[model samples]
Target: MIPVTRRIAIDERELSETFVRASGPGGQNVNKVSTAVELRFDVAGSPNLPEEVRQRLARLAGRRLTLDGVLVLRADRFRTQERNREDALERLLGLIREAAVPPPPPRKATKPTRSSQIKRVDEKKRRGNVKGLRRGRIDHD
Candidate 1:
């Protein structure tokens, strides 16, 4: 099981891992060995996650989620599959952990303060005056 937070957990079976060749740092072995980890998790239809969490996860997942609602993460920074696998799981947990907390309360609607409005007007007037002064002197009528 993967623990997202104290309240949220996911089954390890929910995650799918595929290994492929990793580019960079391994020389010829890089081309031959499949060490990169491609981790996929289905967020939409998963039974483990709450509806609200699923919704948040979908929106928060960005380009990582495929059209079929599978969350895809590529872990190639490390050379070994085990390291890459852990890295992928860490990223998944990080993402889920970020979304575990409730969002901030909506701000109350507010009108502009009279003093602030007046200040804004005064600043605009000052700016206009500065701009107006830049014009060359007008010819006598």
Candidate 2:
């Protein structure tokens, strides 16, 4: 089991991994070896995730998530398959941990203080006066 949080633990069997060829850093092995790891987690079907967490995970997954609600992560930053696999797993866990955090409460609508509003108007009037001074004087002979 992979413990995401004190309340959330994910079963290892819930995850699926696929190995594919990665294009980077491994001169000869890059072409022959499948070093990239593709990790998939079914957020929709998982019994471990709460409904709210599942929804947040889907939102956070964005394009990486399939229409069927599976989260996909591709890791090819490393040359070795083991490193790539671990990288993918770490990324998946990080995403889950992020999703687990509750969103901050919505900000309440607030009116500007009376003094601030007066100050803003005063500044605008002052700016207008300064610009008005910059204008050339017209003669009335």
Candidate 3:
């Protein structure tokens, strides 16, 4: 099980990993080694993550979550495939950990103070006077 938060744990079986050749700047290793780790988690089908967490995860994943509800992450920074795999898993854990946090309650809206409203109007009037000076002579009077 991969621990996301203190309360949330993910079953490793739910995750699927595929290794592929990494693109860009790998030098000679770019063509020879398949070190890139593609980790896919089915956010919509996973029973391990709670519904609320899943919803938050999907939102937090943004572009990572595909139309089919798969959250895909690519890891290729490390040289060894094993290290890249671990890196991918850690990223997944971190993402879910972030989503597992309960969001703060919505704040109630309040009207501005009377003094603030008066100051805003005064500022607007001052700005108007400053710009009014720039007017052409045809309208200057």
Candidate 4:
């Protein structure tokens, strides 16, 4: 079991990893070795995740979540397959941990202070006055 939080633990079997060839500069070795790791987690079908976390995970997953509800994380920063695999697993754990946290309390709506409102009005009036002064003088002929 992978411990995401005090209350949330994920089964190792729940995760699946696939190795693929990494793109970008790694000399000729990159072509020969499949160093990139694609980690997949079934967010929609997983019984391990709480409903709230699942919803949050879906939101956070964004494009990473497929139509099948699998969360895919690709790791290819490292040159070696082992490092990439570890990176992918670490990233998966990080995402799960993030989802496990509760959302922050909503911010309380606040009205502008009387002094600030007055200041704002004063500034607007001052700006209006400046613009008003820009008007050309009228001819009294």
Tens digit of per-residue lDDT, candidate 2, span 23-135: 75778888899989999999999999999999999999999999999999999998888998899998998999999999999999999999999999988877777776679
After superposition, the stretches of candidate 3 with alpha carbons farther than 4 Å from their true spots are: 109-141
lDDT of each: 0.88, 0.91, 0.90, 0.91
Off by over 4 Å in 4: 109-141
- Model 2, backbone clash pairs (residues 3+ apart or across chains), number: 0
Candidate 1, 1-141: lDDT as tens digits? 777888789998899999999877888889898999999999986898888888888889999999999999999998888999999999999888877777999999999999999999988877777766678533322
lDDT of 3 by residue, 70-121 (tens): 9999999888899999999999999999888889999999999999999999
Worst 10 residues of 4 by lDDT: 132-141
Q: What CA RMSD would candidate 2 show?
A: 4.4
TM-scores of the models, in the given order? 0.75, 0.77, 0.74, 0.75
Candidate 1, residue 33: how far the Cα is off, in Å: 1.1
Task: Tell me the deviation in Å of residue 41 in model 4.
Answer: 0.5
Pairs with steric clashes in candidate 3: none
Top lDDT model: 2
What's the residue-level lDDT of 109 in candidate 3? 100
Candidate 4 clashes: the total is 0
